[model samples]
Target: MSEMQDYRSSLSDPKSRKFETFSYLPEMTQDNIYKQVKYIVSRGWNPAIEHTEPEQAFNHYWYMWKLPMFGEADVDKILAEADACHKAHPNHHIRLVAYDNYKQSQGAAMVIYRGPIKV
Candidate 1:
């Protein structure tokens, strides 16, 4: 059997930025994002969108795109809201979040857009 790679050796650059759980992986395609949204919907979690400047992503509060989409089942509507938020704040980072009412906490969260890297 081949040896497993060391996780420590694959550490990301400290200066480089990361957002939420999906950032460690390769950039997600539209289909991949849709799948994730569908999964959240399947789990009966409420979907919400938030945006903030990349610089403030770590410590600042994100402005919600609108109210949490409680009982929303349409994945397309979720994506459309995300798209509208991006159009409104093209320079801000956008993220999709799922609130678990049963658990009284967040069920899932992922960055859907990374703002242009400021030099």
Candidate 2:
């Protein structure tokens, strides 16, 4: 377990070339995704969806399918978009991100996993 932790820590280092700009905040699941996104929207954060193939899961430079900006009223739309991205990339890792415009940083994130880590 410590070895894996060390590996993850090394990957996160900026000089490692494997630095991740994103990460999962909670357990991966559809229900959790909706709940987290709803809470973020309630806080006035904008939602966005992104994904990447399992092989590139740790690459950090995942592809953004939808840019953040979906407002509270568009919660369902964003949720559906997240679902679609998961379906399209069933063999990949999908995530939902909420950006707090005022904070200028990611407000929250949730991942929908496809399988266990190779390690």
Predicted model with the maximum lDDT: 1
Q: Which ten residues in a row have the lowest lDDT in candidate 2?
A: 15-24
lDDT of 1 by residue, 52-75 (tens): 987778876999998999999999
Per-residue lDDT of candidate 2, residues 52-77 (tens digit): 87567666688998565556546678
lDDT, candidate 1, residue 119?
48
**Where in model 2 is the C-alpha error above 4 Å?**
1-29, 115-119
Q: Candidate 2, TM-score vs. the true structure?
A: 0.67
Top of the candidates by TM-score? 1
lDDT of 1 at 1: 100
For model 1, the local distance difference test gives: 0.89
